[model samples]
Target: MTPLFSFLVLSLKFLSADCKTEAGFCSCSCQKKELIMKAVSILTVLSAAVFGFFVGISFPVQITPQLQCGILPCSSGDAANYSFSGTSMIGILWSAFRNTNIQSNGTSENHAVTKPKGAEKLPPGLVVTESDLHMRRLWGSPKEDVATGKYLLALAVGYSEKANVNATVHKFSDEFDVVLFHYDGRTTEWDDLEWSKQAVHVSARKQTKWWFAKRFLHPSIVAPYEYIFLWDEDLGVDNFTAEEYVKVAMKHGLEISQPGLDSTRGKKTYEVTVRRNDAGEMHKTNEGGRCPDVHQRPCSGFVEVMAPVFSREAWTCVWHMIQNDLVHGWGLDFNFWRCVDNPEEQIGIVDAQYVSHHGVPTLISQGNGEQEGSSEKVRARQWAEMHTFRERISNAEKERGNSAAALEEYHP
Candidate 1:
């Protein structure tokens, strides 16, 4: 029977028959027909509202032209806390998570996340449509330092060797979106094309290679990747895997997590400082990378200068450090200082897998001498700037959330 009819019949029977819920308190003042109509009215109203809510969002969504970070909120049955699940960040149950940002004060238990920053300022294109309804598929934004979204992996390589689409896109044992920039390849505007590992000819590099970073590598790349591997033409690894590295990174949040870098004839290692309690899983080791020491394998400050992974968050912090401030020569590798020791980003070194720089360094010995010396001067200036950035990061970290024990890791 229809719900209205069923309710009407039951009400009439209760009124006439010996049925009562709580005796005197269960007495119905309203007529049976009146009670039945009210219940039906409420149900109909509720059903319509719910149906409307769904229909409102039925069409494909569009990205709001303006860049907005997405994130998800947590819910019951969720792990109660977010974490990296080796590949995709789980816990994001839907798409609303994309609206979260630092400024948003929302109360939700579970959600996924997009990176921070971006806005649309188009007055003419403000009209809405399906194409731009960009959603990260996660529910909402997460709290700070909480695992909320996927960090894209990116690579910046020289266009010459990579000019003909010759560069190989390394696969993470886990899946991730990898964006490649064949910077300023010939005839391309902005002059470079954003591509993945597709076999196609890239353009030639623009002549204005900054002596320091060499070519035009934007700071924007820092926003997309959780960790970016800045690599040159020759990077090879017999056994190093990206999936293993992510596991290690979660164990130790470092600004620059350079896995035990193994080079041609030697190894150099740097330890990331963290305030781990004695009971924590991170083993304590002495100064050098010796065991019983429990620290890590060998490391050279610049063991290979070939491929180094800089986490997206870490890279963004690093981007502010050197972008536009330093000209050239401090070298992106050497410029990255350990935030592990400072107040800001304490970078750590991990031991998982290693990548080898396959290209051999060859001296051309033909550039103009004055020009070379000028480049050297520029590089030296960069070194000084790098140190300045390091100090600033340390200062910032301390201001945000420095603990009393944080100073224990600071040698200077």
Candidate 2:
């Protein structure tokens, strides 16, 4: 029994003896004193039993060596066999309870209880996965067996451009994750190429690259990649190496960049994209009369949508700017500056690692034959989409300006 309970029991016995010996001197009669003593004796015994039970359990428990080691750090050899004292065990339990209480109250300084400042702006924990090319082992962790690539190379491809696509995939090392958006629904045929087995194939017949990107490449889905290469399959990568291009882009701090187009080859729609033999590794070209100013697009901060590389941060904003209906991405290139700060410096072309844009009318002739005025029809749609995009941006700017004016007026 506990010392406290034993003392209480002894005091009760003494009181009962005193009552019997000085029955006349006592405040109550002997009969009443006997009844009261009987009740007090029963209660005292019951209370003492309960107190003793708690005291017994509170004594130092013989924990196994494994459990003791888990509770406290164990040194090698005999130290691991040592048992915890009652005092030490109690202290450990009290400490654990106190920590749990602090966490439950949400007042703990621990990371689990309180988030760091600016954590709200951080991206969520997300990773992209592709279909396994081979059967997985039953024993090992799935993550251990999977090889995650750092960069992404996404292409909109047709079966006709298989040779060019194969050449393009070869330009990139295994560090890049290849994802082919098949517009012709001929995914099985690509299996002939060795790299095709590892690549992720997303088949959607007669859909534009923009449409595929919008539907599949959500910001969260591709968040793990350092950079995303969204390109058309018609591009020639004879002069380009993905690793070298990344190095040049990183050296120049280009967030939104592209490989420079060969001057003589490909449709030179924009003068800024044309590769300069005299220009060092990369350059921000200036189209004097075409652009309103040297700081603007087509003069600076410009790359065609045919082949563009985006940093993870920049692509998040660009992905949102892509319209659902306007899959052509005609006018989107002009507004690419909105995604980055000081676009004149961050957006440019890598001249050292350039690509030849083959103006193959592969995509234009998908649903319809090239001889049946498909080119004209596509061009007309592009013009209409560009007009709609410009109007939307203009309207958005006007609304924002009006809201700011009203807020200022109200405060003043």
Candidate 3:
């Protein structure tokens, strides 16, 4: 019995003796003593039940140290061997309590218990596990397992433009890894060129450059290259050399740039992209009445999508901005400023090394016999895509505004 129960029993015995001490009513006194003893017995039983309930509830707390001993290594010889089975109720309760305490304390041990092993070591977002385009020999140990080029040159080409493509490839030295995107599905025909064996080729019939880039040039796949040159196949690279262009871009810190279009040689669209004879290496054009602001596009902070060169960091942002279905890349050049901090300074036209835009009609001629009607249809689709992109941007901005307002109201 507990100490309280023993004390109560002794008091009941003393009360019974006092009741018997009363003379002239021994019978009544004995009855009263029996009644008092019965009351004491009931009280003792209730007290024991209450004590047992408390002990049962506190069982998990009492075993917490033991549970810790099982989870973590203990210096004590006895505790080191202590085993805890989670199958029992007490063990489950202890585990829950331990986890709660650890989370409240904000300890790294909580992360260790919840996250998978080696999860913290991985980079954010999806990781690419497949090998790159770098070729390997089958016979012997190679000096290097990957491509040594620091830059990447990707072109969307057709067999009709083979002569122009060959000239463009020669402009870039061994420091670049060449990748050809064949829209005509005619890769074997280009084998006549000696460099075609070394270049990587991807073929699909009647697809635009944007479509090829979106599906193939994921940021992770091209992470090793410092700069990526995505160009059209019809450009004349007579005045352009890959090495000199890179040096000029690096000197001026151009993150998103393109070669200036020769005014006298080929078809030109934007006045800003026209090469300035007076500029040294790079120049940002100014349109007096066209652009409302000096920092806006079509004047400054812009590069055409035809022959754009993107730094690795800039391309990571641009890759996400490319809409999957909008393969024509309409209105993409206008929004390129969003990827860079100061587009006016980082985005420019390389004047010293410039190209002639041949304005080739490769994709327009692929449709059914009516070339003029097909060209009109292409223009109509480009217009529709531009409007759709603008609408999406507007909707996103409104949603962001609403969310911010709601958050502020909740906090305030």
Candidate 4:
């Protein structure tokens, strides 16, 4: 029997006969049939209005743009979290939307999707479409793989005979993103090599590495990477592996660190930076009588400008300090400890993987050859720049009511 008829019959039977509910409430009525009919009519209209209101308030969700996929409205499922690969965002969306057993051309179709549970409802004044989400994924805003390695190697090359850029690229290519900042302006020669083709190249003529770095390797550009190896081309890494160096540095918690320099290659002034393989990954050595605060000493809070490796946090601060006009980076190393916190423990040399300085002195030689750039002239300009940097730092410290540490040393 129809629900309405059965209800009507039951109502009539209850009206005609004496009835008692389980709780002992008694009622008898026959004149209320007209009243009951009016009540049902009111209920029917109210139900329709409520249903229409719900549908009106719902956010319009577009799962599939192309008819190639299924068109069924979404249901609750775990399919939205599934991983899939495709060139187009639509294909990726299709993968997440698809979970139905129904097949189209041997592929299971997900045309019928339900509203995902816990999905955020659209708020007022905000409009997000399928295309917007797709564009975000296509660009840099996609989901990040937290487990993936985050390191990069930035090499500065001038095609100079003594630099050996190609050999360095081959040595650490697998451990990091080997990027070539070509200062020679010739892009054609690197096109022949497979590694060169894979690497990111930034070209400029006769400019130093710091110039390219100031423009391209900004904190924003290298934000995704955890560590950046801002290295010169002349270093010999035959005794080191990039992976081992990083491991040791990480273990020791060094933020601004570098491989210990082999002092035999050149005249070494600071004894702390000299390699010592006899101890742990990092030795507790320092230039005696320096850093009265017991921290910020050489080989602890300081690393040489050449082949310096900076952690992401340290690099962000260092990038802001780099002057656009000062390309040589002559006076920057002395102030590097200011960028990091607890530099004594957070910065140190990794003696486990040391590199030999080829001692080419390419930048000084190149500048000296220029008409306005004799070695004496370059030295004077460098000193002026360093003096300016010191003045700025001093002013900043004075404004903050904090004293900045000055370079100190004592002979044994």
Better of 2 and 3 by TM-score: 3
Estimate, for each residue in 351-389, the C-alpha lDDT of model 1 and write its tens digit.
455544444321121123456575455445546865664
Instruction: Give one digit per residue, the lDDT tens place, for model 3 in 4-104.
Output: 66766666675655433457368657666776777778788898987875565455432213434445755222342342221234435454654534233
Query: Which clashing pairs does model 4 show?
Result: 70-111, 73-113, 74-113, 74-114, 75-113, 75-114, 98-110
What is candidate 4's CA lDDT for residue 190? 73
lDDT of 1 at 150: 50
Superposed Cα deviation of residue 180, candidate 2 (Å): 0.5
Tens digits of per-residue lDDT, candidate 4, 261-327, equal 7877643546667787676677645745354444544535778788899998999899999988887
For each candidate, the alpha-carbon lDDT, in order, equals 0.41, 0.76, 0.77, 0.66
- Of the candidates numbered 2 and 3, which has the greater lDDT value? 3
* Candidate 2: tens digits of C-alpha lDDT, residues 85-198: 222344345556445332321222122212333553333232223232232457878788766778899999999999999999999998888899999999999988998988
Which model scores highest in lDDT?
3
lDDT of 2: 0.76
Residue 118, model 2: lDDT of 50
Alpha-carbon deviation at 116 in model 4, angstroms: 30
- Runs with alpha carbons beyond 4 Å of true place in candidate 2: 1-102, 105-139, 287-292, 368-374, 402-412
Give the higher-lDDT candidate: 1 or 3: 3
Model 3: worst 10 consecutive residues (lDDT sum): 403-412
- Show model 4 residue runs off by greater than 4 Å: 1-149, 161-163, 173-175, 287-296, 368-373, 403-412
